[model samples]
Target: MSVTQQRFMRRGVTKFLFLKAIADAGNVPLRPELASANATDLSGAISDVAGWSLANSPIDTPDMGSPMTTNIPGEDKADSSSLTFYEDLAAETIETLLTKGVVGFVVIMRKGDVPASKSMDIFPVRVAGRAPAYSAGSDPAKFTVTFAISGEPTLDAAIPASS
Candidate 1:
C-alpha cells in the first residue's frame, strides 16, 4: 500500500484530520465519502493523542452529498439544512454535557499552521473554524465552531462568500 495511505489509516477520524486531508488533497476537490473516511481515521488518531475518545465521542459521519443544500430556493431552506447538520454533529460532541445540564459553548478550532482556502471550494462540513496562526493578536489555538438550535443556525454561509 502507499505510504500516504498507510499514514492516514493510523490516525482516527476527527475534524482536525478532516481539514488536514482536505488541505493535503490540494487541487483535488474532496468528496463527502473521502472526508468521512478521513474523519474516521482522524478520530482514532485523536483518541490516541488526547488519550480520550473525543474523536468518536458522539460519533458522527460526514455529509454524503454536495455541500450545497439541495440547490433549493429561499434562504431559509438552505440555512436550515446547514444548521441541522451542525446541530446534529455538534450535539454529539457536547451530548454528554447536555444531559448533565449544559447548553451552548464557544467551540474554537484555533488556528495553527493551517492555511485559508485557495480553491474557493466550500468545505462540506457543516461548520468550519479557522484563523491566521501567525498573526499577532490571533490565537494559534483559536478556531471557530459552528452552532445550531431549533433546527436552524444563528449564522449561515451557504450563499458562498457574500458576507
Candidate 2:
C-alpha cells in the first residue's frame, strides 16, 4: 500500500514578493518574470498576513415554477487583505516601500523561496492604508498595511526559471 504525503506552508519558508509597478493600457500590470530584479522579497519583514482570497456572491434566482430557489455564482471579488510587518525605519524597509497609494503586484509563494517549478498567486494591489500597532509589552514594533486588490488575481500560476 502506498501512502500519499501532504505538504504544508511552513514558517520562514513562505515568500512574499512585492513588485512596485504601474499598470499599462490594458488595466493590468505586466506579469513579472520569475525572480525578477525589480521584485522585493518582503517575507522577512512581514510578521503576519490576512485575507488574500477571492469570494463569490451567489445570485438568487427563485422561480414560481419550482419550490426550491436556484442560485448562481454572480461575480468574484478579491477580498480585503492586509500584511503586518515589523516596522523598520532603517533605510529601504517595509515602512518606506509600502506607503499609502502605492500600486504593485503581490506575488505569494506558499511553497517557499524555491521559485522554479512552484506555483504562485499574483495579486494586483494598491496600498489602501497604513496603521501603526503600538504596544506597551515586549513585542516588537509592528504596523499593518491594508491592500485593495484592483483586479482578479492570477491563481496557481507556474513559476518559471529565473532568466
Candidate 3:
C-alpha cells in the first residue's frame, strides 16, 4: 500500500473513504471537536501550517492575490472576484498533538509534481505528555480550555512562539 494510505490506516482515519475522493484537494480532521479547528486550520500549506490558536496567530494571512476580471473595452468593472487560500485541518491536528503531548512529526510528499496530482501529507507522533495522558471516558483530570486534547483531530505541529 502507498505510504499515505498506510499512515491513514494507522491513524484509524480509514473510517471515511470520502477522503480518497478529494485527496489532491487535501485532508480534513476526522474528529474536529477535539482541537476545535476553523478556517485557519484548513488553510493548506506554507503559511506555516499549525493549529488555530489566537494565542499564536493573532492575525489572519494577508491576501495573496486579487481575483481576475474581464472588462469590455472601456467598461469600468466587469465582475469583482477574489481568490483565497487556506490550509486543511490535518496540519492543525498535528500541531495539537505536538503541544499537548511531547510530539514528533513526519512530512510526506510524492515525487514529481508535473502532473499537479502529486502532493504532500503531514502526520504527527503521539507525544508522551508532561502530565499523565488520559484516554477518553477514563475521567482523568481535565485542562481549563473549553477543549482538551481528546477526540479532535490532532496534528504534529506545536503552537508557534509568541512575538
Q: Rank order by TM-score, top first?
A: 2, 1, 3
User: How well is each residue in 35-63 modelled by candidate 3, as lDDT tens digits?
Assistant: 23221222232222223221222333334
lDDT of 1 by residue, 31-74 (tens): 45233433332222122121111111232344667563343233
Worst 10 residues of 2 by lDDT: 22-31
Please provide the root mean square deviation of candidate 3 (C-alpha atoms, Å).
18.7
- Residues 1-163 of candidate 2 have per-residue lDDT tens digits of 9999877755776778888763443223234543456678888888889999999999999999999999999999887899998877676477778889998889887786454534677898999999999999999988899999987787776665444
Selected candidate, larger lDDT, 2 vs 3: 2
Q: Note the residue pairs that clash in candidate 2.
A: none
The Cα error of candidate 1 at residue 77, in Å, is 4.5
TM-score of each: 0.19, 0.84, 0.16
